[model samples]
Target: MTLILFTQIFVGLALVFTVAAFGWRLRLFNALARPVDRSTPKGNPRLGILYAFTLGMAPWAKESTRRHGIAYLRGVAFHLGIFLVLGILILSPWLYLLPVTWRTLLALGAALGALLGLAGFIARFAEHNLKALSTPDDYTAVLVVSLFQASAGLWLVYAPALPLFYIVSAIMLVYAPFSKIRHCIYYAYSRLFFGKFVGSRAVLPHSQQGAR
Candidate 1:
């Protein structure tokens, strides 16, 4: 009975997120804000490449953190941890607990990645709430996601009543579409859009574009 209910919940959330993401991609609810990529890089080609890479990270790394002192660490941890955790979670045999020699390494990598992500989130929350740079929506989104992640971690630790953890995860999945957390998907496209848009406008110097 519990397993059936949990399976239903998972299927339901998957359907909703998939449909909502498709809707978002269709520009159903997204406001058509014009491109805001006016900050042009200087003549240094290496600097321009660096700028492009950093712009890719800017979506997750809140702009507000720059006013505070945590922009570097927050940006680094958030991006690198996201990369590591996402990669290992998808590719590692640990996903199925399959017998493999690399399971320990993958487990450690995932743990460290999650920890790094938590640190980044903590830094963002401190800068936002404690420093007064956060909007109400910002605070709410961060609080919700932080709680969701912490709950997931706890569930993994206790291994108790998988249904309860599934409930929490389901809530996270539903909330993510409506919250700033959707930026996880939105950011990648935004980066490519920015790059192509800039290139079309002849904003990037030729030497930088030719760098292969």
Candidate 2:
């Protein structure tokens, strides 16, 4: 095979496998010593789905470390910024397949939205890292998501051809599902379980009998 083809095959396979392995590791950890929570329920499928949807789409509505006023502003700004960018992502393929006008508007919204997210990322990193409030993985996770979004912005700035942009996006799609970024999808359900549901359930109750 040609060098370019060989490299793509090698890199893509390596990335895919590494991510899959990490996912397996996460599953093992979850099985062996689950994280503590005061929120999950006793396997109610309907409630589980509803909770997941609510948390995934509405994380900002929940309380935060920040108090009311600051939380309101931060949540509004972050979610609005995410919302605008997501709308643009939905529109991007159409822009590619359609006219310049469509492309221009989509590109503009995406560019500005990415910039906003980048700024928030920097602010969050400063707060978490410098303040020593973040775990190493937490900081790394933020950095990866920041890089992913920034890559999208860079793709826009350079106006790389469709193939290259697709390559970057594909890598991101594969990487995100394996990374802390998966929290975006699973966070809501996780919260519902650990937060609202945990306390309400009697199943998996604390052991009153002492271990011998």
Instruction: Output the worst ten-in-a-row residue range by lDDT, candidate 2.
Output: 203-212
* lDDT per model vs. reference: 0.52, 0.50
* CA shift of 153, model 2, Å: 3.8
On residues 1-212, what C-alpha lDDT tens digit does candidate 1 reach at each position?
67736644684676478568757764853666765656564344444344455753455444655555454665455455445533532332234354444544544544454565566556656654654765565656655544444443443344453355455546656766777767777675656565565454445534554453
Predicted model with the maximum lDDT: 1
The reply for model 2, stretches above 4 Å from the true place, is 1-52, 55-61, 65-95, 125-130, 154-158, 161-179, 182-189, 192-212
Q: How does candidate 1 fare on TM-score?
A: 0.57
lDDT of 1: 0.52
Model 1 regions lying over 4 Å from their true place: 3-15, 21-25, 29-70, 79-96, 100-130, 155-158, 205-212
* Candidate number with greatest TM-score: 1
